[model samples]
Target: MTPEAFFFEFPDGRKAQVALGDRFLVAVAPYRQRTHPCQVHYFSSCTGELREETFSVRVLEEGKEVLKAQVRTGKDGFFELWLPRNRRYTLEVRQGDWVAQGALTTFAQSPTCLTELRLSRR
Candidate 1:
């Protein structure tokens, strides 16, 4: 038996890289647009169906919500969001029946920060 592998490609020649000074990175890639590299890929309402155009993001720290950012999916269904420094966040996105959730790590200048729900489904 052989292990199957997944591959991603980006279109529009746009790319996001985490620099030495940067603390966060986000990206979205859609099929049929062209092969590109993306940290995450979204599925359409139908299982196994690829989607393009729609995404949302949020940030949290120490289990406390902090920042929220909304993203518009491009023709290729790709979106990107940035977070503050030295903090953490719970990221969520919904597309039709499909929903994606994950945690993002960041940093804060102060030792204490506010907690709140930064993002939600509309």
Candidate 2:
């Protein structure tokens, strides 16, 4: 069975197409005069090595799970997603027995935000 997809509309009347199982950013930032996308890079916590692996990422808004996706990092351990500025979000990443999670709030003044997460074995 295919999972349900969720769509978010920006204040400017642009909608983001998000598929249920597809890898994408989970949060939607408010409409801004100038907007920037969010970029994330994942690394290994133990060896400080870049990892290109499939990981589960979930985005939470207001303490509710709003989006979930499975994303694979590129050879450079990089992925990109768009988020609304000035909003708080919970991001969780999991790979095998390793997990890393954090909270982020996109800045209203910046055109883009770059985040790096390192996963460690539990």
Candidate 3:
């Protein structure tokens, strides 16, 4: 069996080299339109340690659902999502009894690098 793969593809026709267990932010925007690459790091805040886990994730834009999936954290304990630029979003992550929800935004001055969604026991 082959391991699952993930990466960023450039509009100029090039694939990013994102091996498993690596963390990076790659974005290719054209014509003033952009897709914000949000590097998500979900972990336990209990011990200030990174947790490798899977969680059911839901993203909403202006109260409207935009994305939902069961995202598995990589060996580096992180995942990535791309959303339209200049918008506000709400993310919900759930794993067993631990859950986290937070607001995220992509604006002109906003950093497109990372989003740290820390979880706590419910």
TM-score of each: 0.41, 0.53, 0.55
Error of 3 at 98 (Å): 0.9
Report the C-alpha lDDT of model 2 over 12-56, residue by residue, as the tens digit.
999885553422232212211333344322222111133366778
Give me candidate 3's TM-score against the actual structure: 0.55
Q: After the best TM-score superposition of candidate 2, give how far the Cα of residue 10 lies from its true spot, in angstroms.
A: 30
2 or 3, greater by lDDT: 3
Candidates' C-alpha lDDT: 0.40, 0.50, 0.52
lDDT of 1 by residue, 1-122 (tens): 00111233358666453242443434433233234332233322111113355544545556666756666754444454444455556655555554556555444232111111122334
**Best of the candidates, TM-score:** 3
Q: Which stretches of candidate 3 lie over 4 Å from their true place?
A: 1-51, 113-115
Minimum summed lDDT over a 10-residue window in model 1 is located at 110-119
> Which segments of model 1 are wrong by more than 4 Å?
1-23, 29-52, 106-122
**TM-score of candidate 2 against the unseen true structure:** 0.53
**Each candidate's clash count:** 17, 1, 0
Q: Write down the TM-score for model 1.
A: 0.41
lDDT of 3 by residue, 46-122 (tens): 11123356678888988889989887655544555666666778878787877778776655454433444556678
- Model 3, C-alpha of 33: deviation from truth (Å): 37
